[model samples]
Target: MREVVLVVLQLARMTVTDLLGSLNLPEEHIQYWLNRNEALHNFCSQNETCYSKYELNNKQCWGYEASCSKKDSFSARKAKCTKPNSWQKQIFKKQADFAKLAEVLSTITPICVSNYSEGSSLECSSHLRFCRAKNIFFDFHNLNAKNSKRYRNDVIQKGQAGGNCNMLFNEAALRSRADEKSYLQSWAHELEHFSSYPTFEVSKRQCDVIFEKPTVLIKLDAASSMYHHFCDFVNLYASQHVNGSVDMDIDILWWDTVSFLAAASPKPLIIHYARNCERASEPSALATVIANKNCG
Candidate 1:
């Protein structure tokens, strides 16, 4: 039975962690399998081949190179882990991935886009007023699995993962006084989330549903229906803050796969930004043109 679940997880392109808690496996048993079973360890390690240096932590496994910490072990604990670029990226090839996302969106929703906050943040979807004021966070975090000093010890990194947005980067220290003043001002953006391996739930309208083809990298599938779920969740979340109304102006941005989803479906108004493309000297506007038709 346990072997059956493990096989299913691999087929789903998921980690043992995905099946760990639900399996009713005891802690010691699971750990021993993960640490002692060479084949099992090897399988878990292959799950992250596409992560960019900016996306990994420890980076030590034979094939994988990232560190993970759940406030404590056990699948129930709150911890952080890293994910590579979606497998879909490899299957479609970046250019084709963007085209497919754009093409799919064109058939449904509207789109909009904007440049990311120059010295963006892992803090929240938007630039925090205080963050911008203190000039503490600059750009994004990208670390090599091979290096430890690359990551800020104080700022806990929650790789963009499931739960409403593609990733909710929660700074571990925010809950404590280590960075009090800034924490208070930015608390508005703080929200707890729920997640599985490739999916995260935020609200009815918002879903960080990472997509996977039988043999492809994960990609955002922002078809109109799925995005409708995201917006619906956002709207529901807004009701509590907006005095009984969800503002249409509040927008959601896509980080990594935003471009990919944008290209998959074109009819929908789904705007997105691609900073690396511009900086990568890779023809910056390639994605902008695809998402522009629907962007506000």
Candidate 2:
């Protein structure tokens, strides 16, 4: 009965999205919220026994009072369930594919193949000059059109704005401001004395340097250099990790990125992205973004 109801709810949500047509939210964003809805239902159901036990004793139910108030309806449950960070974190983690992404990231050979290996002064200078000229060097604002004209006109126009490290390297955007590229380029060279390790543990740790900074990650474009690098790398790694290639949809990637960011960083960051990012325009999309913004 619960499964049937969940299915019906999912269909209803999809129907609303379809009715919106081009005005609908990004398919990726829509599906992301749908997944969240399912997770919310599952979470509420899983704790049903606990809620009942608490009620029987005439005690205040932990997640029920503020979140699941008026438990007779699903809409009320959803609105309330999204209020707490702890609840959001659990819902975000319920994504099995996200675990796969995380696993691949933890296991794969990282972009940092070596510790900071300084280049010659002339070489570093040239790289810096190229970056500054293209406005893709250091300032995050420069890479974003909202801040720098050179960035919007040159970097974005040249197709360098929303690519992964591999794509950036392919497009010769490697010397730009990407944290991954910066380490792989001159900055690491300055710290060349730091030892390098070829093992997965060191690679994972090096990657963590980027992942640990969700605040920075949330500021850049979702498809920006570092973001795409991490997301695409996971897909590539997962393909090799399993028997056949695992080709996850772009929507799933978006969902994973959003959920991860929501869990680790401030809600305002994600909310700002939804409100400001070029891709997010419709009301429903903004609502979903705001709704899921509180993930712990």
Candidate 3:
């Protein structure tokens, strides 16, 4: 039975590889897929029970959800080690392998970028004030003194005071600081160590259910002054689509973000900036355009 399954997987891989080749993907992509597929086939054959537990739909293997978590119980971790070919490994490898390809695929003409009503700087200011209010006694001066030299320098260079927005503060330090002032200062000190900006948050909305083909919806907030940060976030998000599907809808709330830049400069000037940004061989020109015109 296992022999038959192995043979079938071999044929399927060959067929899929040929189909992928027809799509004109890079040779490296095809080779990488072939190698990974072979590993998958071998694992399935060697451990039929575990392979049987995984979900398969439309020729895509969606590995078990329970195996995806790193914080799983000891028993779950033991199972993962015993099995060795868990879905979490597959997800990480797939994401890493296709990240660069996803970026290039995003630039394809099939992508539709549209702007909605302008975002409000007032709302952004409100958010910033709220953040400040919540940590009312957060002394940047005190925190700066306590932080490491590297962290202090980074905070000075980039206006980023907090570490990555998604990460949690140190539990030990957070617990140790008895007073609110000390606690908040410790929090600020940790935040400077990481560079994370929340200029825009990307969410996929109804693309899977509404579109016939695979479509991605990227929502960018216009209220953000972080145009350069938005580009970085977009590039990171784009790298996740390993399948090379290019049909994308980018919905931008344009007021404070895109329109703010547009309002300051003439159409001809913006166009010149865009041309200079495109023609420049290095990132310096792009950086200049982004800083001066805020349109890159």
Candidate 4:
């Protein structure tokens, strides 16, 4: 189905949101589709096989250190990457737990993306997740590492990288540039990686488990400052609307083809006009989502 293709694109590291921007899809139409779509759930269940890290020995093993600088540079370079039997055994033991993780997310779909998330600075998101048509960007900033670090580190000095917000979803356990998550400090902030292509869909049952309060939000301009403006906007909206919660999911897009999915779906989707701000500033003006939506 259309969702399946989107998942393939994500697995391939493409950005669906960017792809859509290139097409003639209306932003609201895309949002409407996202508000009522099933592809995200399918992709999550289908692509579960790729969620885990690939042990170094699976393809061709290498003893590259943390920096991936070859220490020996001899057979180390040629070492085949293989599945760690011990790790596999552990996974089997933890199958129940892992299944639980998926079960929780099995019903949720990412309707759209917002690339506007710059912490207190008022900058827009480098990228955002969108539903087929829904504009799910109001809180996109909360889901952004770039925005969080840019703001949090400035205050807490946690040493996390600024603007590096894709959640590090590489399945092969490749050395990632992302730092650890504030919640899962021991583990790299890899959970956010699922946000790129989107890993789960909130089913009715899951919805009961997790409550999502939706609202309108602006995607921040990566380097631009809009913090004060956003706060003011939130207050302004809250005065008129009771549904204002100022929460949105922020994530990265691993693939580029993700931008094209709009051609198949009838629903309107919300996505960055180009790549997420995580990668670039919004085009001087809304150019073409297709031409400018490059991940590289």
Candidate 5:
């Protein structure tokens, strides 16, 4: 029985239904054989050229088609596969937008904070207030600084702050009395959130940045770390929010992040702003654009 099954599977043209019907197998046995045949077919289709060539030759090739050998001419057409569909074109546009944003971010000076003597909670609150007054969206976690050690310990253990926003730094992380460069980088990280100027919601992951007038939700992934996870998050966010009519954008700062997202999530407009502590010394293109256009 095993030998017969093996021979039947080796024959590419033989269908499981026909094989089972001819064998007069029991109903239960027929189902088992059918399943095995399907598994074998799938495996061969992936790993064996005979199956792939047969399938490809039968289908109408979408992109640029190249000729194969004469013997297998029926299945010899090779698709160029380079031409992106409408969805792919949109992703490319988003990636380009991100690159432009990153260029702007790289040039802007970091937000200056002279002192942390009063603690970062107060400063954070002040920054938020300033943003609110200016019609910018900025959220601060651990607003009260209720437990500094707890926040630090939490960050250390979890590798992230206890909140959703990208600017999830604890008071300790903020108050370490780091150099001006570190402070500038941190401020840049926060300010970059407003580079695109979308309204933010209280939701942890879903619809973080919301544009009310336009009814668009922007997914924010500010942490420059974890490229793959960020891409996954962008894809998941788009799947949840983007309907046919709704607008969406995935905002990112790191060039690396933008590159990953470009390949991963092609639906959302990825706004990129590549900047960090090392690049703080340079003049920001974002600032220049704001200065010339009189907008943030």
Candidate 6:
């Protein structure tokens, strides 16, 4: 497994020394590799392309058009541009697949039609299909082109506005600050929250077809921060009840957040903390650690 991981990193043109420095591995483990100078030299010599551009290091190559440095390998430059594009498609597909699953779940379960015809309640009922189906109500707001400025001014004057379970998605804010890929990622973050409905859990086997495996794996700090917020909310709500009573219905919210972040992280570091947060007997401590680590 170590060798396979190393090979993948090498192919991506990442230095093993840099990888070791980033990780919390022991000094002895680092020494073991350093001591094997002959073996290491042979390995690197056989995979010279991993360390340098080799045959493609010349100015004629596409990657060398701007910089003729050997460090700017053809494969590395190609990978750098293509990896993000690939992940963007994967993230968008993941959101679409989850939306389909939510639609299927809504059909199987009973939906509670809202009596209120005009307002945030009605909007929430329409957008959050499964949530309303379960008789769980929440406010939904879309701060778009027409309302973004007014909403921001109101928020500044009255302080941050939100209600219990309320979801406020600012499409304009996301568009103004984030690029297309990041915007899609933000949508994926919201879709993850919607997929955590209890009705979806009842059909776990069927849902597994779409949700079991990750479609994308990348380190997204925004997505990580969102997951941390979800986790923190769960822990805070649980603490409000006497004797640490928790509503099991809401467990899916944070659990799905964990799953999404685990899949989204480039390494297993966030996954490790997320799993620990999930299993901890007490709240706040482990969850706080994860929130601090990711949100920082």
What TM-score does each of the candidates earn?
A: 0.18, 0.19, 0.19, 0.18, 0.17, 0.17
Question: What does the lDDT read for residue 117 in candidate 3?
Answer: 18
Better of 1 and 2 by lDDT: 1
34: Cα error in model 5, Å: 32
| Candidate 4 residue lDDT tens string, 216-259 | 22222222446533433322222111111111222222121112
Could you list the CA RMSD of all candidates, in the order they appear?
23.6, 21.6, 21.6, 20.7, 23.8, 22.6
Sorted by TM-score, highest first, which candidate order results? Answer: 2, 3, 1, 4, 5, 6
Q: What TM-score does prediction 4 earn?
A: 0.18
Model 2: per-residue Cα lDDT over 73-183, one tens digit each: 222234434355466545543342233223222322222221222110111112221110010111112133344321121221222122112111221223331222231
Clashes of 1: 59
Mark the 10 consecutive residues where model 1 has the least summed lDDT. Answer: 2-11
Residue-level lDDT tens digits of model 3 in 168-225: 2332332232122111122222222223233411112201111111111112233346
Error of 3 at 191 (Å): 25
- TM-score between model 5 and native: 0.17
Off by over 4 Å in 4: 1-171, 174-201, 208-219, 222-296
What is candidate 1's CA lDDT for residue 234? 31
lDDT of each prediction vs. the true structure?
0.23, 0.22, 0.22, 0.23, 0.24, 0.23
lDDT of model number 2: 0.22
Q: 29-144, model 5: which lDDT tens digit per residue? A: 32223222344335435645434433422322211112212223221223122553456444443342222232232232222221222111112211221110111222322122
Q: TM-score of the candidate numbered 2?
A: 0.19
Best candidate, lDDT-wise? 5
Query: Clashing residue pairs, candidate 6?
Result: none
